[model samples]
Target: MTATVGALAPISRAACVGGGVIGGGWIARFLLAGIDVKVFDPHPAAQRIVAEVLANAERAYGMLTGAPLPKRGRLTFCASVAEAVADAQWVQESVPERLDLKRRVLAEIDAGAPAEALIGSSTSGLKPSDLQAGLAHPGRLFVAHPYNPVYLLPLVEIVGGAATTPETIARAKAVLDAIGMKGVVIAREIEAFVGDRLLEALWREALWLIKDDICDVETLDDVIRYSFGLRWAQMGLFQTYRIAGGEAGMRHFLAQFGPCLQWPWTRLTDVVDLDDALVEKIGGQSDAQAAGLSIRELERIRDENLVGIVQALKAGQGGEGWGAGRLLKEFEQRLWAQAGGGAPAPDPTAPLELLEIRVSPAWIDYNGHMTEHRYLQVFGDTSDALLRLIGVDFAYVEAGHSYYTVETHLRHLGEARLGEALTCTTQVLAVDDKRLHLFHRLFAGPERREIATAEYMMLHVDSRAGRSAPAPEHVLAKLRAIADAHAKLETPAAVGRAIGQKTRLAAPV
Candidate 1:
């Protein structure tokens, strides 16, 4: 009873069972991808909970990239599982951990869903085989484990049951990819899958440390956050250790540290007892660490931190930072495509109004104004919008050509407070086959008060060759059209201004 590769159609609508955190997240991901979602949860407050999660997802996704996203799809809360799966092309079951509850819910979903639709279980550790045991069409049922905050994180582990066909897995992967997710298919179905197995091992060790008084929860967290966590974000444990081998690689590193495997450094073999006293101690410590903040407040803090980390990874030190960064880049391109292929028809008679953004809390400095570097970021995004308008885009850059800013002059006229809405306008000052000169103005508030101005000289370059190059004829034609239109406008006062003292002193001897 497996859905053939051709049987699975593009998922324009989806059904989600049990609107808890995980289920709600799946709904958010689907809706954000512009897929209408029908959700069924027995809890009376399920709609409120799902709405809260959706709001957070919307905020996080908005901050994650400047590329436009598709208009949000409608979310329908259904009274019954049958109604939810009535017209859905994809059915996602995210009930409680109890096998009996899950089995019952999945059976109901299977009974109601379309025959060609694929069914996925959001089980953290349950094997897909067990979940599909008594199902009428077990071949269509598989585990699709997603991390928390599913809309933001791209990874989803897809584990097929014994009856599951490769075509089913391929269909699942295709659907996930359409929503900007990386679906890692497991070669075999196993308990806990991959990510949670590693996580469980670390969790056991962290528990032992706390029980043995070796380190408190906060201290243990700090150790990871300040040390190997950063390295792991970019290079995983193996690659990080391979670099430690210096000139040699993984083989040499393994040979040097292989003996450590026999050491008594880990408490993985034994389980830590969660006694009353230990539980109390851990709970007390956690409460103190939280400092009386509400759960919602803590969630907000965590989300902001995650956003900052992902953004840093996206920028990386060089270009692509880590696995997560690469995924973020790919997701941005998808968003660009959804937003009408990133093509903007600039009104060349006036400055091109390219971007409007609100200052995020993370961008605020100690003085309560947007940080200096963030201004540059806004200008950079504005430049990207301009490039997109003039036939320079991801495909153009992928072809080994792009514009590199050779010089920039920035003038700060006013301050942007946190949450202040701002807009950016760009004007083509001049253009040539190899160079582009542009000016940008940043305005804040309803009155559109000027906050900053930037002038940039950008050069077309063969990125692979690491040298300047002439713009392609098609691109040059677009730029020329823009320049011709812009030529009719008056030159900006800041265009050719240089930073200097008003009255220059006499030349030094």
Candidate 2:
């Protein structure tokens, strides 16, 4: 008996069979999505290792988005595969990539998990058909190969074996969507799925370059990192090449470059000898490139860089986003939907407490305080939060109407250092159909000392018409309600302060 894909409930409970790098990443991503996870790993250091990965994941997520994330789910370490899989909605096998061992463990999982529970194998280079050969419910097993640092990289190659059912694939995709992952289903099962196949070809050529002494590891890295690597990160290969074809497009690109495939420029199909000298040479060069940073340090640096790239992409093209950035924006919207469309209706009479920002290490400047522009960024975010509270959002703005800041007054009084937790409050000073007035206070630490204040005057504009316009009644209604409630409160002294006017910072809130 099989359940229709539509009948499948959202995945809330999951089981993992390994606790190394890949499996640890899987556990972290699931836990971050608020999915409870059960695990069985015989490694003695599994608990400590998984904890480190989860910490890194939490840090990365903080830098990724401001959307309200769900409460993190619980995790349990079990003594056996059967114990881990019991009652699990999904089971992921990420043990050593050996067909025989995977078959045995999956058979045990099939016996213990719910009959309809889907099973995913994290095999980088194994055909799922081989792993499913001996399982009683082979139709539920497939490959869900993910990249390194799986928590940060969103792509997952979903491949199903011959025995796998369409319903199973559909259900898995639903699970991926629920957790903000991008799963590209393979049309057929094969070893080393699409991503790895391309990576391996590149790896093969790269090794030959090193072995033949054309370039050392660092030089080779510099070549890629400084050139096509960036292009690959954004536009990808064929699309980048399409643009390279000029106005004639991909057809011209192929016509010009297709013949080069036969040239000896790449030794992609050739394998270099892994003799002791070559191995030592590569290892020595790699250590030199690392400059003695441990794996954890490197991982954190990589995570931060990835976050910066993704965030930039998310803000590109007038906030419409591009490629993976578009996916990330959509994911944040889904998160907002799950969290009741953002910050709840606040006490109308008081300043609306919108968000608390942890001063990231990245925010500190040469003088070791939050940089000047970040203050404006926080104020801008507060204004956007207010927009959402009043039924305005990305879709609202994209629909040809939005609030644009025409005037802003910002004052700074205190220093914000790394790791200092800061909170903000927004006060609705005034509002009408075509214009809005807002005041925000930035507070630091437990004492809630006011460190900064910002006032903004915004004009609603019809984007398509390129002129100021009256906002819709529905949006005006929510803003008016808050304005009315706040009208009774005394106005913040920060209001109407002239540029360069001197004033003492107030006491704690």
Candidate 3:
């Protein structure tokens, strides 16, 4: 059964095959952020593959917000292909690089998948036309090629065949957008798509040079990386040339070098083929350079660089990285993420103070949970803020040089994790010339869950003598009025079993 478009039916979950590098990356990208995932791979290490994916996902998700992720999504491991794609709205197939293997997998997905579901082949070479050759419905099948470490990189190439519809492309774009990815639509289905085709052409030429003994491996790599690769990172071939040529532009540069195209210069594509000896040479050189570093070590280095570079770009644009920035803006409009109305407008008389205060990382402990000490510290800050409203503020404490924490206690209720914002509300309880008692309840932000509470007896005193002193007449009168008004007001349920001599539990006993 299908739901109407845009009807807030549950999130469109995905299924992936061949839980290797590419499949693992997809799971990391989607499932960690509360999107469901299903995987089917005959390999025995499929579970390990997904666990690695989840680990990478946790890292990526942690970078997005100062606080923890909303909620983890569901992931199911299916024993067979049919079970994985049974009701999945999207399926990503990443089996071995064999035409027959892909054709069979597509056939299985076509048979069991819903008619509206979109199926993508993560093949680096096979064209969409060839992959969908024997499919039951070729229209739903397309090449949704993703780069390695797909969760970190935002670019996805969507190559469609003759049967593909505009609506299908639109839906694919929406899915990519939801997960903070940029989808580029390739107008026609071509072999090896854009990025791969460009790299393959370069590879063919590099192989030819090494085979002919014209240059060494390191030399060729250095030439490209130090020269053209630097420019290409920010701009493509066409645009880079346009800038180089200046006002004369690409036409001028092409006119100068167009004749060189006919010269027997380099046969990167048609001229040189991947013979065995050349492959061995390249492999030996690669191993020599790589030495003995584990994949995990390499991945950590890669993530650090990606984070740094992307963060720089995002910083330039005021916090929206290239792909994620677009999604972050759109996410703000989502109802669940936004603050709703009818929160009993702020009371200006007893004004809820502290415009804003951020909870820091240091407040967390070795268990990776928020330390209990911080709970009282934040509530104390809130109480101090409320005290300022009635005139028993810093000036009073500084002049007297003494303040009392007479009755201070906290109920250890729920746990708060690292980087979580802890907030508290102070409601005036009772006030006298000598003692001002206040009640405060602390809550974890974002979810608005209650964490702890503090009932304090603040004494105003003289700084020179460190002895209890009555507050001034004006401050005393204002405190009395506030306490009188709030005396009839109710307290929240977080206040456990009446503390000291106070009994203002808002709810029924």
Task: Write model 3 residue lDDT over 1-509, tens digit each, in one string.
Answer: 00111212234578988789888888777764456789899999889877976675565444332222324557889989999999899889988888899999999998988898989888988888888888888998888889877877777899987777788788888787666677899988888889899888888888888888898788898898789876675566999988887799999989987898999877854767667887898888776766676677667556645554453444445655434444443443331221112112336355243322334444556887777886776777576555555555445556664446777767767888643555566777777777877777667768868777777777877768867887778877877777776766776454445553375558776
Lowest lDDT 10-residue stretch of candidate 1: 1-10
What's every prediction's RMSD, in angstroms?
5.1, 5.7, 14.1
By how many angstroms RMSD does model 2 differ from the true structure? Answer: 5.7
Tell me the tens digit of each residue's lDDT in model 1 across 322-428: 57777777777666544434334657788998887767666878998889999999999899878877778778899999999999999999999754668899989
Model 1 spans > 4 angstroms off: 1-10, 337-350, 357-369, 396-407, 417-421, 429-437, 444-449, 457-493, 500-509
- In order, what lDDT does every prediction score? 0.85, 0.85, 0.69
lDDT of 1: 0.85
- Pairs that clash in candidate 3: 400-462, 400-463, 401-463
lDDT (Cα, tens digit) per residue for candidate 2, span 83-199: 999989989999998778888888999889999899999999899899888788899999999888989888889999999999999999989877778889999877898989998
- The better candidate by TM-score, 1 or 2, is 2
Model 2 alpha-carbon miss at residue 200, Å: 1.0
User: Which candidate should be chosen as best, given lDDT against the real structure?
Assistant: 2
Better of 1 and 3 by TM-score: 1
Give model 3's TM-score versus the native structure.
0.63
